[model samples]
Target: MKYDFDYLIVGSGFGGSVSALRLAEKGYSVGVMEMGCRWETDTLPKTSWNIRRWMWKPWVGLRGFFNIRLFRHVMVLHGNAVGGGSITYANTLLVPKDSVWRDGSWSGLEDWESVMPGHFNTAKRMLGVTENRIMGPADILLKEAAEECGRGDSFYRTQVGVFFGDEGEVQGKRYPDPYFDGQGPERNSCIGCGGCMVGCRYNAKNSLDKNYLYLAERRGAQVFEETRVINIKPLNGGEGEQGYEVTTQSSRLFGGLLRKRRWRVRGVVVSASSLGTQELLFKLRDKGSLPNISDQLGRRVRTNAESLIGVRLPGDPEMDKGIAIGSGFYLDEHTHIEATRYPRGSDAIGFLLTALARGQPGYRRIFTWLRTLLKLLLTKPLLAAPLLLPFNMARQTLIFLCMQTLEGHIDLRYQRRWYWPFSKTLQSFGPKIPTFIPQANEFAFNMARRIGGLAGSVITEVLFDIPVTAHCMGGAAMGKTAEDGVIDSRGRVFGYQNLYVCDGAMLGANLGVNPSLTITALSEHTMSHIPPKQAA
Candidate 1:
C-alpha cells in the first residue's frame, strides 16, 4: 500500500495551487507537476506584438499559433508558468450566481449552494480580494456612461486581487506584507502597468506564487516545472484500492509541440485548464490510458457565450496603461460589458475591437464571422482602431468586452500522427463561439460616435472563424451517475480510486462570468471529502 506520493497534482493553476497548499498544509507529501515553467514579471513577453512568442507558442523552442491557443469552447491563454494560469488571468474574482449550483447534476449533493459562501469568503481572505476604491480612467468613463444611460449607482468597480495602497499612492509605493500578517513577501502598489495578462513584471499582481503556491512550498509541496503529464492510470484501483499511477514527459515551451518522455506518480489531479485537461483525458480515454472514463467525457464544454469588444481612443495619451479589467457593466440582465485596457500601441497592428458574433449551433455562425472578419483584416488602422478609441483615450485606446448568455460547448479527442486531437481542440480551438456583429457592431459604432473627434473603424478576429477563451472549463463533467459524471461530489473519478479530477474540467456547468473564483471554491470544497491519508 506504500505510494510514491500522497498526492501528484498535474498543472499548477488555481485548482492545483489550492490543492497543493491544502494537502501540504495537512502534512501530506505532495508532488506538483506543471507543464510550463516559471515566468516572473520581467521574463513575461511584453507588448501585444511581442507577446505572441510567449502567449501563442509556449515552451522555448515550440512554434505555431498554439501558444496562446484559441478553441471553439474557450480561448486558452497563459501557459506553463510557476503561478499556473494566475500569471495571466485578469485577477477579477467573482462567485457564480446561486443558480449555477441548483442546475447542474451535482445540485442534489448536500447544500453546495449554501456551503459555497464559506469557501468563497475563505478564498477571498487568502487572495486579498477587495473592491477597487480608486477607479481607473476607463472605469470612471464607464460609470459616467452607465449614469448617463439612467443606470447610475449601478456601476461598481470589480473586486480585483491586486493590492493597491491605503493612501491611493499605489502609483509608486512599495509595502512589506501589506495584506498578510508580515509572513508574506514584500509587494509594491500597482502602477496599473496594463500588463497583467502578459504576466505582471511588477510584483503588484497577486499571482499564486505570492500566496497560495508561496505558502504551500513553505509548508513542503514540491512543484515540478516544464513537466507535461502524458497519461494517468490506476495502479491498483477498486473498492479499497491503495494508490494511483501517473505518467508525463518533457513539455516544450515553444513550437506548439510536446515530446513524450516518461515519468510516474502515485496520485493525479488534472488541473490542466479546460483544453489541456480535456486533451489529456481524451488521450487517456482514446489511447486507452484510462478507458474506464465516463462516456460523457467531452460534453457541455461551455464558452460562457463570451465575446470581446473594446472602446478606446488612440493617441489621446493616458490610454490603456491602467488596471487590466477596471470596470464591468450589466448592459442587461443577461449581457455584460467591462471597460478593458492594454498598454497603448500594443500589438499596434491597428484594429480595435474584437467583437464576437454568435448564431444557433453550427456553421451558420461561422459564415457570419467570415464576412465581418474580412472587413476587419483588410481595413486600415485609422479606418478601424481609432474609432474604437474613446475620446479621453483617443490619443491612446479603449476596449470593451461584450459577453452574452447563450450557452455553447465543444468536445476534445485523441488521434494518431496527424489527428491533431490536441491541435484541433487546442490550436484551431480559436474560441469556436457565436457571432454578433449587428448588435455588437452597432453598439461599438454608437459608443464611438457619442465620444469622438472623428472616430471610425471596424472589428476583427483570426481567420477561419476562430475566437479566444480565457476561462476554459469542462471535458469531464458532472452527471447523475458513473454513466455520466466524470467524478462524484468529492471530485473522485467514478470508477477509479485514489484518482480525482479537479481544475476547470470538474466545472459541470457554465457560470456566465469569470470562473476563477468558482473553480477555486470548488477545489476548496473537494478538499473536505479527501480522507486524511490514514496513519501508518
Candidate 2:
C-alpha cells in the first residue's frame, strides 16, 4: 500500500538516528518524531546552572533536555532532546566484555561475538571514536586509587566519541564532513571543558545530529522536534499488510490546543529508550491499539548494577578541566570504575552527591544515612562543609561511576497510587535491589583516603535504598518466543510484522559500560535485515 512514508521512527537517539539514516539509504521515506527541541552549538546552556535551559521540567516552563525520572527502585537519568541521551551523556563509549552475550534472554540465539564487531566498527567510525584526549588531575587521582588498590595495570584511557584533532590541539578549525565524506556536518576540536554531560556547546562531541541524523536529513528523512507520538494502530485491523497510522501531538505549552496530526506509514520503529518505550507501549496495549503485545514487556530491566560515588578534593588545581570521562580502572573482572567530571560551575547535579555509607535496604538505610552524616560532620567538618553548604562542588569533586556486570534486574509497570490518583504512574514491582555495593564503597573510601579528601555518594542510596542509573536498559527484550519475550531476535515484535524495538530496551544483559555504542550497532543490524523500499 502507498503511504505518506515508508517508515515512522519514534525517538531520535542512538537507535532511531541510525535507523533513519540506514533506511533512508535503502530508499525508504522516513519521518522521525522527537519530544524535545532541536539544540544547536550556539544555543546550548553554558553551564548546568542555566536551569531554564538545562533541566527538563516542562510543566514548570523549563524545556531542557535532561530528564530525571524517580521510580521506587531507582532514579533513572535520561535525555529528551533531539539527540536523545547523546545530548547529556558523557562521551565514554566502551564495549562490554564477551560474557555479556552469553547471558540474558537472547543468549545462544546467535554468535553475537562474531556478529557485533563489524557493526561496532561502523558505528565507531561514524561517531568519530577516539581515545580520551585530556586526562587531568582527576585521571591521575584515579590512577593513584588503582595503584593504592594494587590494580595499577588495569587503569587506562577511555575510548570515546569525541573528536580530538591532530596533535590534540584546540585549533578552532573546521573539518568538512570528517566521517561521511562531505555528507555530514563539519566539526571542531574539543576544548576539554568536561562539559559533555551538560551538552557540547563547542560542537566537539559527536552527538547523533552531527552524524547519522545529519546525513538522514540530507537524504530526505523528515524530523519533527518537540513532537510526540500519542497512538499507533495497524491499518484497518491488519498488521503491516496494509500499513500503519501514527498520531502525534506537540508537547509544547498550549500546543495541545492544535489538532493532532495523523500520518500513514508502511512500517514503524520503536527506538525510544527503555523507559520511554515501555511507558508508551503500556499505554498503547491498555488502549487496545496493539492487543497482542507480549506479557514480558516490562521484565528484566537492568541498570548495570551501577553506583555513583566520588571524592571531593578542595583546592585541587585544575581538577575539572579534563574531558567528561577521561580514564577508568577495573577493580576486578566484574567491577569497573571511571573518573567522571563536569565543567566548573556546572554544580546543579552536586546536590545528588553525599557522604558514602554502608547500609541494608529499607528504613534501616535512613538510620545509616543519619549516622554517616553525623560521623562526617564530627570527624571532618572542613571537608564536609561544602557538601552541606553551597559551593562549586563540580569543580572540586572526582566522581566515580562504578558499574558491575553481575546479573540483577527490576520490573516496571504502570499503576495508580494515592499520590498519582489521576493517572497510572511508572512504578517498580519486584524484589528490592541492593542500594549499596560494598566493593564500590570500598573503592571510594580508598580514593578519599589516598587523596586526603571526603568520600561521597548519592544520598538516595543511603536514605531510601534506591540506586541511580544513567544506563537504564532492557524491558522490551528479545527472546525465542512470544511467551518468553516481547520481541524476536532481530527486534521484531512477536505478534506483529514490519514493527521493531531497536533501542536500549532491546539490550538483554548488563553491559557494565555505557550502552550507546551497543544500541547503535544493534540498530544498524536490525535495519540491515529490511529490504530497500520498492518503487511505488
Candidate 3:
C-alpha cells in the first residue's frame, strides 16, 4: 500500500536530521514535519545591532521566538526554524563522559561506551568537528587560571564545528568548504560574532541546515516548516499497524484564514525536543489520539545539571565579543565549566555557573538572582558602591557554564487542573526537581577559587539557575520493560510496531556536554533497524 513517503519525522533537530539524511540516502520518500521556518543563515542577524531579531520562538509568535528571555539558571533559547535548535546553538561540541553511559537503565542493552565510537567518528566527520582554531583573550585567561591550578592539561580548546578562514583571512570571508573536498557549498569563516547562541549569520556554524538537513532535502526528504502537528493517530487503528493521520496547524497563515489539515503516513518517528516530543506524546496518549503509547511517557527527563557563570578579564573589557561558549574549565572528574560569551554591546544578560543551593518551589533561581540584584542595589549606596561601576561588572564578570555527568531526571505528567477552564493548563513543567547541591561539585568550585575566580552562585536554585543544556534528553527512554522504558532497545515503541524514537529523548541519563554527537550516533544506530526506505 502507498504511504506519505516512507516515514514521517516529528522534529528537525539532530536526530531527525540524521534519520532524514540516512533514510533519504537509501531512496525512501520522507516527510519531515518541523514547527518552525527555514531560517536562512546567509543573512541571519548578528551583533547587538540586531539580536532581538535574531532569536526565535513559536508560542508567543515569530517575534517572541527570537527575543527570548534568560533567567539566572534557565535560559529559554530555542530555534523556531526548520533546523531546530542547531540553528541557534553555539558549536562547542563535546561528548559526554563514559560514566554517564554506565548509569542508565539501558546501559546493558549494548556496550554503549565501546560500540559507539564508530558512530561518533562518523558524526564528527559529518559535523566537521575540529579543535577550536581561534583563541580569544577570554580563552587564554581561562587557560592561565586552569594551568595555575594544575589542571592546564585538561584545558585544551574545544572541538567546535566552526570554519575559520584561510591564513590571515578574517573569519567572515566566504570560502569553499574546507573539509568537503569541494562536494558541498562554500563556507564562510566564523567572524566570531558571538551570535551563535542567537543564530549564526556567518554561515560558518555547522548547523544541521547546512549539512545533514541540506543533504537530506537534496536527496528526497520533504520538509515542511511552520507546521505544528496538533494530533497524531494510527489511521489503520491505534493497534500496531497501517497509516497515520497527522492533524496540523500552520503558523504561517492567520488562524481563521486557514483550517486544520491532515495527512497520512505509514511510519512515524518522534524527534521533537525533550519538551516538544514529551508534550506531543502526552497529547497523543492523554487525548486518546494514540492510546497505545506507554504509561512511562514522561520518564527520564534530564537537564544535564548545567549552569552558566561569566568571568570578566582583569583588564580587557570586551571579552564577551567572541564565539558563544569559546572556552571552558574542567574542574574535576565530574564538574565541567565553560566560558560562554555574547557579542559585545548586547544587553547585559549575565552569566550562569552551578551546583548551587536549590530554593523552595515557586521561589526559584530567578527569584534568587532578583534578590542578589536587590542586595547589590541595597548595598551600593552603603558599602559596595565602588564595585558597582559598569566597567567593574564587565571586567569582573566571568560567564561560567557548569556541567556534570551526575544523574537526575524529571517525569512529565499532566497537572490536570484547568487554568481559565478554556486555557490549556496541560502545561509541561518539572515535577519539583531535586535540589542542586554545591558540595558535590566542589572540586570544580575549588578549581575556580584556586585561580581567584569566585564561585558564581546559581542566581537561583541549582536546577533553575546556571542552567545550560543544548541537548535535553530522555522523556521516552528505551528499555526492556514497560515499567522502565518507552522505546525498546531497537528503538521500536514498547508495545507497538513501526513507531520509534531516535533522538535525545531516548537517552535515559544526562550527558555532560553537547549531545549532538551521541544523538547522531544513536540515530545512525536506529536507522540500521529500519530497512532502506521502500520506493514509491
Candidate 4:
C-alpha cells in the first residue's frame, strides 16, 4: 500500500519530537500532529496572569499553552504547544531512583539498569543538561528546612536543561551554538528569571522545539500545529498490515465549522502524553476502529503521588530570582520535594493553593479542612488575613513540588456521565489515591514555623480528594502480553504490528522527578528498535 508518510506521530512534545527527528534522519517521511499552537520565544506570555496566552480552553476563547484538566481523583496540569510540556515545564531533569526501574508491568522485561544509561546520556547531550548556576533564597530556605527535618545531607542542586554559559567571566550572556555546533539554535544563559514555567522568553530554557523539532524540520519532517487527531482506523481490516486511515480536525475556537482532513500512513506513533494516548485509544477501541486493544488500557495510571505545598512570606525577598525549579531535598527514601517558583508578578498559580489539611476521602477530608482553617484563623490570624488580600505571591512565596516514589495509582475509564450529557469523556475510576502525604505536610509546617510564614497546600486535595500532578503517566503500560498490559516491552501494541506508544502513557512506574528526560530517553530507546527506512 502506498502511504502519504512513512510514520505519523501524534503530539509534538518530548516523545513525538524525538520520534520525528530520529525517523526523518533515517530517511522516512515523518509528520507530527499537535493540537496546540507553535510558540516562539518572543511570543510567549510575559506571565501566567495573561490568561489569553497562558491558559488553554479553546471553546471559551482562551487559547493558551497550559491545560489544567480536572478528573474526579486528580487534577492534571500539562502543556499544549509545539514543544509539548517543555514549553511550560520547570526544566529540571533528574533521573529516578534505581528502585523505580524494578517496579511495575515493565519490570523484569529488560535489564533496564544496565541498558538505560546510554540512552539517558544521549538524551542529556541533546537536551544540553547543565548544573544550575544561580541558587536563590528559595534554595537556601530548602536547605534550612532539610536541616530542620534532619535531612540536610539530602539537599542538592538540580541538574537542569537551562544554559548557564561557559564557566568564567560573565553569566546570562548569549552564546553561539553551544550544544550542536551550529546545527542547533543559539542560546542565552539563564538570567534566573523564574519564568521557565510561564514559558521561557529569554531563550535560556532548552525546550524541545529549540532542539529535536528544530532538527526534525531541517531534515524535512512536517509538523502540523493546531491539528487534533479525531479518529484512527486500520485500513483493509488489518492493523498496520495495510497502513492506517487517519482523520483530524482543527482545534481552534472555530474547529466545529472546519472540515476534517484525512491522511494515510504506514505506521502511527501515539506519543500524545499519558492522558491523551488513553483517551484516543479508548475512543478508537469503543468505536471499533482497533478492536484488539487490551483490557489493561487504562490501568496502572501513576501521578508521582504529588502535592504542591507552599509558604507565604510577608516581606519581599526575591524568591523569583532563581530558575523555576532550582533545588530539592529528600524528606526520606521515598519522598522528594523541590523548591519551585514563578517569575515576579506571576501570581495566577497562587489561587490554586490553600492551607494544608490531612485526612482520607469523603466527610473526613471536609472535617480536616475545617479544622485546619480554624487553626489558621485562631493561631495565625495575621497570615490568614493576607489570604483574602492581594499580595505579590512570587516575591514573597516559596513553592514546594513534593512527590513520592510510592506505587499508588488511580485508574481511568471512558463514560458518559449525567453532568455532561453530550459526548463520552474520560473519568477517574476505582479507589481514591491519597490526597495528603504526611511527610510533605510535616516539611511544609516545619518550614513555615522556621520562617514565621503561612504553610499551604492545594485546596482540591482537601475539598475533593484530588491531588494536582504535572507528571501523569502509565495508562497504556508495557507488559509481557495482552492479558497483562496494553503494549509490549518494546512499546508495540499487543496483537498489532507497527503501531507504537512511546510517551508517558507507556511509563509503568512514576519517576520521583520530572518525567520529561525519561520520556525522551525511552523514546530514543523505542525508536532505536526500528531499522532505517528501506530504499525503494
Candidate 5:
C-alpha cells in the first residue's frame, strides 16, 4: 500500500537524525516528527539565564531546549528541540568499554565487540569528532584535582563533536563545509565559549541539525518541527503488514486551534529519548492501540549511575571559558568524572546546587546539609551569601559530572500519582539510584579546600535523596525474546513489524560516559539491517 512516507521517525536526536539520514540515503522517503522548535545559531539563547529561550517548560510557557524532569528516584536532564539533547548536551563523545557488551540483558545477543567499531567510526566522522582543542581554566582545574588525588594519568582531553578550524587561526572563523566535503552546512571554529549546553551560538558545535538531520533534509527527508506524535496504530488488522497510522498534534501547549494530523508510514522508528519512548509505548499498550507491545516496556531503565559534585571558587577564575566538558578522568575502575560547565552568565542551574554535604542518605544527609548551611551562615555570612546564590555560578564554579559503570536501574510505570488523579504519567520505581558517590564528593571537597573555595552538590541529593543525571538511558532494551525485553538486538521492537527503537531507550548497558556516540552508532547499526528501497 502507498503511504505518506516510507519511514516516520519520532524525535530528531542522535538516534533519530542518524536513522533519518541513513534511511533517506538508502532511497526511502522519510518524515521526521520532532516535537520541538528548530533552532538556529542566531536564535539560540545568549545565556541560560534567558529561561524563555533556554528552558523547556512548556507548561509554564518556556519553550527552550533544556529540560529537567523530576521523578521519585532521579532528576532527569534532557532536551527538546529539532536536534534534541544535542542542542543542550556537552559534546563529549567517548566509546564505552568493550565489557559493556558482556553485561546487561543484551549480553551475548550479538558480536557487539566485532560489529560496533565500524558504526562508531561512521558516527564519529559524521559528528566531526575530535579531541578537545580549546582547554580553559576548568580543564586545568580538573587536571590539578586529578593529580592531587594521584590519578593524573587518567586525566585526558575529551573527544568531542566540535569543529575547531585550524591551529593558531583565529577562533569563530567561518569556513566552507569541512566534514562532508561541502555537502554539509558551512562551519565555524569553536571560540572556547563553554556555551555548548546553553546552545552553541558560535555555530561550532556539531549538532545533529548541522550534520545528519541537515544531510537528511538535503536528501529529501521532511522534518516536521513542533509535531508531536500522540498515537500510533498498526494498519492491516494491527499486524502492521501494510503500514502504520501515526497521529500527531502541535507540540505547543496553547496550540488548541492546531488540529491533530494523521499520516500513514510503511515503517516507524521510535527514536525519542528513554523517558519519552517508554511513556509513549506505555500509553499505547495501556490504551490498547498497541497492546502487543511487550510487558517489559519500562523495565531495566538505567541512569548511567551518575552523580553531580562540584567546587565553587567564588572569584577571579574564568572556569566557564572552554568547551563544555573539555576534559575528564577516571577516579577508579568504575567511576568516570568530567569537568562540566555552562557559559559565563548562565547561572540558572546553580539554583539546584548547594554547599556539599557528605553523610548518609535520608534524614542524616538532610541534617548534615542543614548543619552545613547553618555553619556557613554563622561563620562566613558574607562568603556564604554569594556562594548560596545562583549569581556568578557559571563563571566561579567547576562541576564534576561523575558516572559509574556499576549497574543500577529503576522501572518506569505509567500510572496516576496520588496528587494528580486526572491522568497517568510516567513514574519511576525500584531501588533508588545512589544520590552520593563518596569518591566524587571527596574529590570535590579536596579540590575546594585546595582552591580555598566551597564544595557543592545538587540540593535534591541532600534534601530528597535523589540524584541528577543528564545521561538517562535504557528502558526498551534489547533482549533475546519478547518476554525478556521490549526490542531485539537489532532494535526491532518485539511483536511488531516494521517498528524499531533507535535511541537511548534501546541501550542495554551503563556506558559510564556520554551515551550520544553509542546511541548514534547503535542507530546506525539498526539502520544497516534494513535493505535499500530498491531491495525492498
Candidate 6:
C-alpha cells in the first residue's frame, strides 16, 4: 500500500526525536508532527518576563516553550516546542535505581536490569552528559542546608547535558560540533547564566534539536512544526494491519482558517508527553476514531510524588548565577531534593509563592499561613517586607524541588466539567496526591531560620491543597496483556498493529529523578525491535 511516510511520529520530544533518528537510520522515511514552534538561540527570550516569548498559553495568545497545566490533584509543568521539555528542563540526567524495574505494571516484563544500562550509556553519550562544572551561591546554600540537617554526605553535583569545554578555558567560547564529530550544530560553552529554563541563548544546553532531532532531519526525516494531530484511524481496517490515516490541523488558535490536513503512514508513534498522550487517546477512543484502544488508557498516571518548596533571602546574594539545577542531595532513602533557580530578572513565578506555612491540609493550612504572616509582620517587618515582595525574586530566592520514589497515582478521563457543559476535556480523577511533605517543609524552615530568610512554598499548596510537579509521567503504561495495560513492554500499543507509544506515557515506574534519560533509553529499546527497511 502507498503511504505518505513509513512512520508518522507525534510530538518531537525526547522519545519522538530518538525514534525518528533510529528509524530513519534503519532506512525508513519519517514525519514528525510537533504542535510547538521551532526555537533557536537568537529567537529565545532574554528573560521569562517576556511572557509572549516564554510561556505557552495559546488560547490567551501567549506562545512560547514553557507550559503549566492545572489539574484537580496536581499542577503540571511541561513544555511545548520542537525540542519539547528539554528546552526548559534543568538538564539533570540521572539513572534511576534498579528497584524501579521491579515496580509498576511493567515489572517482570523484561530483564530491565541487564538491558537498560547500555541504553542509558548511549543516551548519556548522545546528550553530552557530564558532571556539572559550575557551582554558585545557591549550591553553596544547599550544601550548608544539607549539613545543617546532618545529611551533607548526600550532597553532590548534578550530571547535566551541557557543554563546558576545557575546565580552565574561557566560558561562552564557541566551538565546532563537539559531540557528533562536526555532523551536528556548533555549540558554545555554558557561561553559568542560570538561564536554562528561560532557554539557553548560549547554545550550550544539549537540547534534542542539537542531537537526536538534528540527526533525524539529516537522515531525511521531515519535521512539521506547529502541526497538531487531531484524529488517527486505521485504514483498510482490522486493527491497523494495513496503514493508518492521521488528521492534523494548525495548532495556533488564531493563525487562520481551521483547515485540516491528512497523512497516510504504515505506522504511527504517539510520543507526546504523559498528559498529552492520555488526552489524545481518550478522545480518539470516546469518539470511535480508534475504539479498540485499551480501557486502561488513562490509569496509573504518576507525578514522581513531587513538591515545590523554597527559601527567600531578602538581599541580593547572586543565588541565580549557575545552571538551573546544579546540585542536589538525598534527604532520606526515598526523598530527593535539588537546588533550583532562574536567571536574574525572571521573577514572574514569584507571584505564585508565599511564606511557607506548615500545618494540616485544607483550612488549617490557610489559618496557619495567616498566623505565620502576621507574626512575621509584627516581629520582623524589615525582613518580611522584602521576602514577601516579588522584586529581585530570582536573585534572592532558592527553590527546592523535592521528589520521592514512593508510589502514588491518579487517573485521567475525558469528560465534561461541571462549569463547562459545552464540550468534554481531560480531567484528573482519583485520590488527591499529598500537598505537603512534612520533612521537606521542616528542612526548608530550618534552612530559612539559619540563613535569616523566610521559608516559602507555592501559593496553591497552602491555599488550595495542590502540589506542583514538572515531572508528570505514566498513564498508557507497559504490561503483559491488553487487559492489564495499554501497551506492551516494547511500547507497542496492545491490540493494534504498527502503533506505538514511546514517551513518558509509556513509563511504568515512578523514577525518583528526572525521567528524560529513561524515556530516551526506552525509546531506543523500542526501536531496536524493528528490523531495517531491507529486512522488512
lDDT of each: 0.66, 0.88, 0.67, 0.89, 0.91, 0.92
Please identify model 2 stretches exceeding 4 Å from their true place.
none
**Tens-digit lDDT string for candidate 1 (96-172):** 67877776556776588778899899788878888865566777777777776666565668888887876636375
Q: Score candidate 2 by TM-score against the native.
A: 0.97
Cα lDDT for residue 155, candidate 4: 94
- Candidate 4 stretches with Cα past 4 Å from truth are 358-361, 374-379
What lDDT tens digits, residue by residue, belong to model 6 across residues 1-536? 78999999999999999999999999999999999999999999998889999999877888899999998889999999999899999999999999999999999999999999999999999999999989999999999888878899999999999999877899999999999989999999999999999889999999999999999999999999988899999997668988899999888886525767999999999998988899999988988888989988889999999988888887788989999999999999999999999999998888888899978898788999999999999998987877677778899998999999999999988999999999998888999899978999999998988888889999989888999999989889999998889999999998889999999999888899999999999999999999899855
Q: Which stretches of candidate 5 lie over 4 Å from their true place?
A: none
**RMSD value for candidate 5:** 1.1
lDDT for residue 37 in candidate 4, whole number 0-100: 92
Cα deviation of 379, candidate 2, in Å: 3.6
Q: Where is the poorest 10-residue window by lDDT in model 3?
A: 349-358
Worst 10 residues of 4 by lDDT: 382-391
State every prediction's TM-score relative to the real structure: 0.85, 0.97, 0.85, 0.97, 0.98, 0.98
lDDT of 5: 0.91
Predicted structure 5, TM vs. truth:
0.98
Better of 2 and 3 by lDDT: 2
Worst 10 residues of 1 by lDDT: 453-462
Question: Which candidate do you rate higher for TM-score, 4 or 6?
Answer: 6
Q: Could you tell me which residue pairs clash in candidate 6?
A: none
For residue 35, give model 5's deviation from the true position in Å.
0.6
Residue 149 C-alpha lDDT in model 3? 66
